[model samples]
Target: MFRVAVICLALSFSLLHAETDVEENDIDIEDESELRSKFEKFKVQYKKKYDQAEEEKRFQIFVENLKASKRMQEQDIGTAIYGITKFSDMSDEEFGAFYLNPVISNNNDPRPEEMLSADVAEQLTNVSLPSFVDWRKLGAVTRVKDQGLRCGSCWAFGSVANIESMWYIKTKKLRALSEQEILDCDFRSTGCHGGHPDNAFRAVIQLGGIMSEREYPYRGRNGHCAFKQSKAIAKIQTYRNIRPDEEEMKIWVAHSGPIVISMNATGLQGYRRGIIRPGAYACDNFRLNHVMLVVGYGTSRGYPYWIIKNSWGADWGEKGYFRIYRGEGACGINKLPITVVI
Candidate 1:
């Protein structure tokens, strides 16, 4: 009963945003000297070492991204704060190539007949929904992971996270599962390029189970399959897609476990912290390019947000996590939510 209610809430936030546009000059321009100084500081902070020619090229890109971040801050309707991040030095195209996976958004494959669909109603009935849910607090969530610039493997990380939490929820044992195994053995996906979470889940079942991170550590790039059946640690029987309702998603998170979701990550490159609620121009709902884990949800100072676990390392947004506006399908978040059955 509770699972049904939760799925409904998750779907509500997936369709509330209307498409809109913003002017190109929405950002505030800063002095050149000040911008340069900040760039130097950014380099020092991130330990960035570049040749003279590359330094100049990267500095210009950094400046442009700074302006873009400022524009996002000014045009944002929610309380999201934007600034320089580890990705600030890369251009939009570079960032997309390095981190975002296009296959997820372009995937048109039919759902498998054997794959179970989430049994959820459109709205809550007698089951009471919690106002908040945080799987990290419940010890079901693992530490934030880093996918690195070498691979666009957020799909593997997202699926692994969901499986880890579900495995813990069922067995009372939390294990950092191996995404490298999927990156290498999941022939259904293009290693270091992109993949679909459902594909990862299916591959897990086919491969018997996944190994622990210690046994099959991530290399941030494609490698020959080194999966040892003897070291397999966690497994899933099947996977389910939640109803496209935000309310139901919330209920599901509160009652079940974390969910693997794909969304538009255009505005995430410069995100520092705070709940991001950007306009459609900044974060298009139809442009889903990145996959992440929905660990929990709650309201922040009147702004309802989904606590998302990103695979961008602990130095990024909210210590390797980010919060997106709820009930609005922000960044196409509710477009594709899938979880595993352990």
Candidate 2:
């Protein structure tokens, strides 16, 4: 559910800029100087010290980000607060190609629906829901933060991470699962291009589970499957879809383990830090393209939010974690939630 929201979020934002060009040469000298001054100050505050060799390249990207920042601020569009960050050095195209991957295949066209069995999604209205849950802090998920790099295999990473978390919960072992295994072997998915995490999970089960990362390092690109039966470290007998209800999702995560979800992540690209609540940006307007895990749920500033774990590397956005507004189907977050039945 949340996955669709994220997928849509990224896709809409990407589509909005696909045919446009960034013209940077016409900046007035005064404005350019001010932007440079702000960028320099931001760099100092963040300790993003660029020595002489990287200055020219860094400055170019900084200028682009500065222009974007001013434009966004001037329009006063949406509620997300934008600023220069570690990613202030990468252009939108480079960032989209590298760190951002929205599911762009046919599955993206009609808006995805629950595919597996006709088993109507169960309503967990009677389920015991917790007010707060933090799986990362509780030690159920032992893996460290991960980076998807240039691959569009967030589906693979999200699925593998959940399986790995289940391994820890059931067997008391934390083995980093091989996402590369899925990237290479999962024919049902599109590897680095885009894929459904649900399909990736099905691939894992059919392949008799996955191996540790030590057995197969992530190539961030599609390659031959080198899955070794002897190296299998984690397994999922079956995976099921979670009810597309926010309350039910909280109950599941708090009681069971982390689950993969989707939501509008377009705003996340510019996120520096803080809880995200979209204003003026509605869910119906975006497309779902990205996939990630819902690690936990909590509140800040008296507002409820979901603590989502992204695969865009720890260097991005709050150490690769984000909090989106909870309830009212935040950015269509409670849309197509799925979990593994290990």
Against the true structure, what is each candidate's TM-score? 0.88, 0.77
lDDT, candidate 1, at 109: 57
lDDT of each: 0.77, 0.66
Whole-model alpha-carbon lDDT for candidate 2:
0.66
Tens-digit per-residue lDDT, 1-342, candidate 1:
111000000000111111111112323446777677777767776678899999999989988888888888888889887876777788988876656644332335555544434356534665688888999999999998887646777888888999999999999999999989998999977867777787888899998999999999988778999988888989899888776678778877988899988888878888877899987577777667777899999998999999999887777778879999999998888877789988
Scored by TM-score, the top model is 1
lDDT tens per residue, model 2, 1-342:
233312211110111121122223344535767667766755654456667888878888777776675554444323344555556676777666566544433433433355332333253535566778888887777454454345667777778878887778888887888888998988976787777777788888888979888889876778998988778888888877776677777777887789887554554555655566665543332445567888899877677888888776555556667777778676657767778988
lDDT of 2 at 55: 80
Quote the lDDT for 61 in model 1. Answer: 97
Give the CA lDDT, 0 to 100, for residue 288 in model 2: 55
